[model samples]
Target: MFGKTFAGSPRRQRFLGNRREVQPRLEAAKMMDRLTLLPAELLDPKYGVMSSPLLPTLASKFSNLLVDPWESQAALSVLLAYYGLSCVSTIGLRQEPTFGNEKLITTPIAFDFSHNDHRMAQYLMWGHVLKAVDALVDLLQQLDYLGDPALGKMWDRSLIYVATDFGRDKTRPAKAESWGTGHSLNNGTLIVSPLLKGNRVFGGIEPTTCETYGFDGSTGDSTPGLNCSEGHIYSAIAQALDIEFPERIDMSALLA
Candidate 1:
């Protein structure tokens, strides 16, 4: 581990002259609750850029770090998997740590654009989301977690859902260099999982007005004429996982 106990603290310097910190304090805080628990090798981009003699050592140390209880164990578990290490302990459990059987793990990525400055930096925000998801997909593929090979299945039940607070306004400045958008009623969620009925979008977007329309979940047909609620989205996810809920939703179109 990086040898710190709290978040937001500077990582231990790796080299004498390389004063440039490897990880940003803010970004590190967002990823791990305890910055000190991170392995020093990860802080140096060079470790991952090229084969190093220290990879085994770094991986071993990282595996040890996962043994301790932490707030961001779910994220750490993914990180460990990225490094081809096993996360034996329960994620986010502090006391009486034991092997976990949890099939679902959730982590927060700070993609909110509440500040005005973020309005002009949409690309950066999107880039972060893309990079994070790409890394996860790559790791999952490497681990062969996409499907059960024994069953001849193409996909596993694992899923990643990216939900946002709200949607941006349809309107934009006609000729402004830096335009800002406002919060709107419309928004969409991104669901990534091989178990899903892929390559299909349930909602319809109006070209002239840039508005989103509802869809029929049962038939995967555009239902612009009907209105849907947030509960419908929740129901779709539940249906995909084969979990029973009291809420009624026609998620037949959204599930596999």
Candidate 2:
């Protein structure tokens, strides 16, 4: 949840020759417009801005001011560009007919489960998370949740999940530009979401993946890799949203 996200202006350089203070002052003024623009009664600033009656209060009113209107109509262009690079492929899974009406209201999103190359040239950790968020947000908005209050209410119940294989390397990768940034089975998984249930982190990552536990039961084949994280995360999300997982699964052990 970012307050105000601004992409740089393309024509900003043309104004570079102007007073150095002009640009910063203008930007600040625009931001102020956005902040004071919210249609709500302002609470005492002491109580905090969020306490105000602003609709969609969590979203920034200034978000619209981002991006150069001449170059692009999109907000957060720079952040989105950074996001575009780290992402490899986005595979959206339509609700399978096999699930029938059981999945009538739910959508499944599965990303590339392949291990991220630690040696890659550029990788933005937050970018990966944002991509997933963008996808989920797109799915929700497409379903018309943004327009329908009831639909949006139901979406408030939905959960967003982030499942990764082990933890980031404590040392950073060993090769040239690699940095010792490899995998670390040392810490636990990080699960972040605005959904209430997603607030808690889970599991324990030991030196051996074998010791890291995710599921509730002893599924003999459960291995502490990306598979395990995905399974548990899915199960928790399914439980949260009152959706059922597909039966006869390869990842059932992880969901146990």
Candidate 3:
């Protein structure tokens, strides 16, 4: 694991708005300790030297050639399983198409020449999502080949969540060629795992206004008056992991 540390002064000033009144909560601090930092170099298949001795050295043999953009995720998954690690996080895997001597062409669904164009952005967003799923499936296939029952079981219990900053405006520009829109409060989250209790939506969106409404966490029933918050989302994750907390969360309806 990477042993990187950050100074409080810089992080607090830049990220926390230098707010002296705000302090870290005990629960948050404990959660931070559970995080394991993986080396960024592992993303490049060529640099296979792992810092953890518990990991197998054969990881160095994997090729990092950019035949596919999502190959990095598959490589990371192999190393994670070899080391018996539970979770991994990735960033910046989604990028716009590049054109040059070495071409990495990602065909856009629609071309638009505008500073705030949404067509190209939406195409790239879904493209990356699909590629990420493909990579996960590839990793699962490799784990099955290992013939290790325990590793296969761990894969069965694994979950993947993809979160974005915010939702885009429900309406697009009236123009035909180039289009853009502002951000909106209505957004949806994706949870991919076999451990979920049921395949049903816990919230609803108003057709006329394109606004989101909360739902009953205990019954999975619509709760138009109650809005979902960040705390509720975190509570759901804690419940999924079987972590006990004093907070009264209606996770009975959220998880199995």
Model number with the top lDDT: 3
How does each model score on TM-score?
Answer: 0.53, 0.32, 0.59
Clashing pairs in 3: none
Off by over 4 Å in 2: 1-155, 163-179, 183-198, 205-227, 248-256
Candidate 2's error at 9, in angstroms? 46
Range of the 10 consecutive residues with the lowest summed lDDT in candidate 2 = 66-75
Evaluate model 2: give its lDDT.
0.37
lDDT of 2 at 148: 55
- For model 1, the stretches where C-alpha displacement exceeds 4 angstroms are 1-37, 40-74, 77-120, 144-155, 172-180
Largest TM-score belongs to which candidate? 3
Against the hidden true structure, what lDDT does model 1 obtain? 0.53
lDDT string, candidate 2, 175-221, tens digits: 66644345555445543334543333344445633345443323434
